[model samples]
Target chain A: AQSVTQPDIHITVSEGASLELRCNYSYGATPYLFWYVQSPGQGLQLLLKYFSGDTLVQGIKGFEAEFKRSQSSFNLRKPSVHWSDAAEYFCAVGVWGGSQGNLIFGKGTKLSVKP
Target chain B: DVKVTQSSRYLVKRTGEKVFLECVQDMDHENMFWYRQDPGLGLRLIYFSYDVKMKEKGDIPEGYSVSREKKERFSLILESASTNQTSMYLCASSLNLVQGETQYFGPGTRLLVL
Candidate 1:
């Protein structure tokens, strides 16, 4: 079965600090990975995606993710954290062939920014 | 922008009552999916529809039924709502599996069964 793991359930960082949320996926072949952000009581918003090509992929809100095949991980990173960036982050893996666009999401990591 | 809208933001229903959650997408997407979101558990697919009147069971299809009579609308039905079914329900749409791998999501509907 395909699965996504987000190791940190909750992570707190100071404002203006750097942020990196770990994500690993369980899949056989080359995988399509994505990162999403969700605010309280709101749906998820796409952060970044890694389909193919360069290991590093950039997304909206000044977010980026890197796909590393050897580790089977696609981690999301941001240069500087902002108060507005505090939210729950999800890492998802996109299926191919049968359910090409279907996604398997991680439990999520809640990020709290300190003032 | 591709917009996916849910019928309600929050719903409260009594146990044994029939529940219907509606979803609509404006992008004329070919695939529509329904998922349940839990705290510890990630989003679990309940059901999906590829076309009008066509549906498929997802990972967690038990205790739920779906109807897709129209192209852009998909509805999830619970024959008898139960207390354990209280959770947030999310709807998503995509053009297709291969062409559109990224799915657009709706705000979600929080269902609380009493």
Candidate 2:
């Protein structure tokens, strides 16, 4: 079974400040990791996904994540966050080539950006 | 654009009433899924359909049923709606499982059961 854990429940950051959201996963083999963002009353939007290759993956809205196999982590980062970047973020993991490719998601981290 | 559309953006139903949530995707994907979103819980899968009439239970399938008569449309049904079932329902679709595919989500339906 695959599972994801996000340590931070909520994080507040000032406009133009760098932000990092930690995510850890428990899977047997090399897993596919993804980051998703959701606004209030809206569905989730994929930020980026990691299958293989480059450890540093860039996503939409100037967000990036590094896949660290040693720590079983795929942490999302942004150089400078804007006020509009305030939303809930989720980390998900899935098996490499499983039949039922369903994702197991973390609890989610709510981001608050202050201007 | 791969668009996934959910029939209702907001729904209100009474307890014990039957509720249906419709989802349609234009991408001709082979996999479709229904999930519920809550405050602490990010997104819990309710049901998934790999093909027409081929449904599978997800982590949380109790009190929920699904129908997929056609390839593009997937429906989630609540036999007896309860107050605990009130949540945002999300629909997603993806390509076949052979390739590394990412699921695209719909706008979601907020169901309020009272």
lDDT, candidate 1, A34-54, per-residue tens? 898989898888888888899
Give TM-scores for every candidate, taking all chains together and pairing residue i with residue i.
0.97, 0.97
Give the Å shift of residue B48 in candidate 1.
Answer: 0.9
Looking at model 2, what is the TM-score of chain A?
Answer: 0.96
C-alpha DockQ of every model: 0.62, 0.59
Candidate with top DockQ is: 1
lDDT for each residue of candidate 1 in B1-114, tens digit (9 for 90 to 100): 999999999999999999999999999899999999999897899998888999989989999999999999999999999999999999999888663288889999999999
lDDT of 2 by residue, B11-110 (tens): 9999999999999999999999999999898899899899999999988999999999999999999999999999999999999753346889999999
Query: Residue A102 of model 1: what lDDT?
Result: 75
Candidate 1: residue A91 Cα off by (Å): 0.6
Q: How does model 2 do on interface RMSD, in angstroms?
A: 2.0
Where does candidate 2 stray beyond 4 Å? Answer: A96-98
Scored by Cα lDDT, where does model 2 land? 0.93
**Model 2 Cα lDDT, one tens digit per residue, A66-105:** 9999999999999999999999999999765345566888
